[model samples]
Target chain A: MTEQLVLNYSIAGDDFTKAGEAAADFKTVLKKTGVPPDIIRRAAICMYEGEINMVIHADGGDAEIIIGADKIEIILADRGPGIPDIELAMQEGYTTAPENIRSLGFGAGMGLPNMKRYSDGFDIKSAPGVGTTVKMTIMLPKNRE
Target chain B: MKIREISEILGAEVLCCHELLDTDVHSACGCDLMSDVLAFVKDQSVLLTGLVNLQSIRTADMMDMKCIVFVRGKKPDDAMLNLAVERGIVLLSSPLRMYIACGRLYSAGLAGMSEE
Candidate 1:
């Protein structure tokens, strides 16, 4: 028996302050749905980072979250300058963001790393000049109750 | 240490949550980098940062921080204050800079980031 919920959101560009609103809203829904706190936190962090990435680089993007009985899947698609080097981007402390973003308390190059850290499975698909799509899965420990 | 004590020690202005000033906080983390706070700091009820932005409050809320102290006389604007009020998080600003404010609290027994 499988139960699933899929959520879709459009992350707006140019509003850095409003970036985390979607994740916060999801946390509320997750709480109402009786998901474990740890599992909610993992999904929150992953989506929050992806939200920031969308605003910072792609100017905007689309996010889809599929919640399953055993796992949560997050897919973020952005129409921006695609990642030229996945390996370089994955390296902690390496970022292409400007200093202005750093002043905003981000761009320390931990976004991707943190997403990977909080998620159980991670996948990336991108092509330069076209776009990038990041997929992440976080498994819920069944015995969390 | 309680937030009220921190205010007394530094003579800082309580920008918001005056009623909640007596809330006790066992630990504090001082950092301008929100990512560091997210990645490293945990369970610290109070956060001291020079950065002033809406995201600052959001980050603190995400971490379940109870209070945010803006060091170096940095003041939060209306937007940040509104959000803090909604989240019931105290907001304070002190002219004592990051070092002196942190030291005063440390001497008073509030554990620093690593200790937290």
Candidate 2:
């Protein structure tokens, strides 16, 4: 467990049903590494929220997870239409997700906020037509505390 | 409350992970919005929702929830059930609507999430 562990995943946007697979798999990995339960939960929630956003808004994306001794880092990058206003998008109750996605119990305007809430460090970069990338880090507990 | 008791109170049918019914749950939340459900964090909690999509299961898993009760006779698809089984999350189908189901669980001593 001394070395960094890196995992990459290509998320599919065409299928809404498969949205959370990457997050679920990453959770399993974190559990196997014996990370603290709370830290693992936070990391998984961040990843899951990012994955859902990638599927719903970004069309699809690439997820890169780096597991280190002291922290877990997740980078989700997408090539879909980027957010025009990061401030507004980060607001707790603002969402641009379509009605169809809303019907499926998503697009509550909480995805980004939730991700930021659960992570120790959060950053987002998006351009009007370029794409969006989100980086989140969750600090792991030392001495298993 | 133990999941079994919650099941009994709601008259819910176990959809998956029957063996985990004996697990204890301290708090519960009923919401179709996954993000709202994610705002509160608790140990050994239960999620009661009418949302039957995979995100429901995923949300429960993310928050370390022990069980999910699909209200209003809503049933989860096989994929959702499989994910629940894989995550070791108990799934239940209850005939009661969200409001009544939460009321029944609350009356039965299952508390909601504490304000942070």
Candidate 3:
């Protein structure tokens, strides 16, 4: 963790078209850094889902990713309305996104679940009136390191 | 199946990356929902969709899909096509609907991951 390469990105709220730009950029960086393909895919998927969630639910947010030799860590903080119930949000088929978002190919309630599915470690903290922060880590296989 | 074969079968026009026509892909999925495409699809190299947006291309990029077939004659904007070229993804537009395109490819031996 001491010699981590840290990258930061600002996510604009309600910008559906630009939602996944940050994650795409991060994936390119990871590819250039010679991360294993599978590891890169997992990190990219998790980050992309997080990016979409930030656009759909939080209006926008910020993402900080630390790339280490053994593990990659992500911290996404959003100023949008916080989730009142993390448990309900994590359910596989539960979503609070509106119909408009659904037509854009999301809001089936799979974002948070898919994020967790791809990451090795996941944490979510939120207060209704306050904002939300999501932390995730994906560990690289030793042989690939 | 090669991307060219998919194109011929679906009567799709190559919008970009024509040089990649020889690329061989084993599986494909047809859906308008990008999130569903992301969550449920695994190792599918071709995407058949009616949705027209940058997100479709972005989802294909994240999944490392080799080709995208825009069913129902949907056309991506210049920005999307530019991004596809940069990412080396083949873009195709077809007059066929999603169901028919998928059926054609499936009958021609392009498989998809089982939901189970």
Candidate 4:
């Protein structure tokens, strides 16, 4: 594992049914590459939440995962309408997802918070009419810490 | 508790992966919101919910949950079931409502998520 592995995925807008596909694929790659189970699960959860948020809010986006021996980094870049308030969005129970999305069992205002909860490092950049990019990192366990 | 025990307690019908019923499950969480499930659940192997959608199965998969018990007689459609099958997650359908089902599982020694 001397080299960093990079994986890229494109997400389709409004495709609730296919929301988690990229994260699932990423998890598979992590599993095959022999990442620890707990680290893999954390990465998958963050990726999945971000992936779903992309589909629901940003109308799809690009996901890039960089895996190294020390940590895993996930970048979700979406060109959809950027979030209005980063502070509100980070709040646990605030969401702007429409009723239709709510009907599908998402949009409980937990996506961003959940992603942050699972990742060791979290950063977000967003503008009103531009886009949003989320960078998340989960450190690999050292001595099972 | 074993999945089989959960089935017996909830009187749920195993919809897929019957062979895995004997698998052990440490904790359970019942929520209609997949986002909440992803946020709060840690090392929980069973998801009991009434949300019937593809993401439900996807949520179970991402969390490494072993079984999903659909309460209130809510059953997933064919596509959702197919996804569960692909993920190797066992699906169970129970006529009990969410509260009753959770209560039954709890009374039978099936615990919910531990406080983090």
User: Judged by DockQ cut-offs, is candidate 1 incorrect, acceptable, medium or high?
Assistant: medium
Is model 4 an incorrect, acceptable, medium or high docking prediction? high
TM-score of 1: 0.91
Which window of ten consecutive residues has the lowest lDDT sum in model 3 chain B? Answer: B35-44
> Candidate 4: how many backbone clashes?
0
Candidate 3's displacement at residue A145, Å, is 5.6
lDDT of 2 by residue, B1-116 (tens): 79999999999999999999899888899898888888766674899999899889988988888999999999988888889998999999999999999999999898887666
> By how many angstroms RMSD does model 3 differ from the true structure?
1.5
Residues A1-145, model 1: lDDT tens digits: 1568889999998899998888877776777766766667678878888898888989989999998888889999999999999999988888998899999999999888888888899998889999999999988767433
Alpha-carbon runs more than 4 Å astray in model 3 = A143-145
| Model 3 alpha-carbon miss at residue A35, Å | 1.8
Q: DockQ numbers for every candidate?
A: 0.65, 0.81, 0.80, 0.87
Question: Which ten-residue region of model 1 chain A has the weakest summed lDDT?
Answer: A33-42
Expressed as tens digits, the lDDT of each residue in A35-125 for candidate 3 is 8787788899899999999999888999999998789999999988999989999998899899998888889888999899889999999
Q: Which DockQ value does candidate 1 get?
A: 0.65
Put down candidate 3 lDDT per residue, B1-116, tens digits, no spaces: 89999999999999999999999899988888887887864788998988888889999999999999999998999999999999999999999988888888899899977766
lDDT of 2: 0.90
In angstroms, the error of model 1 at A6 is 2.8
Clashing pairs in 4: none
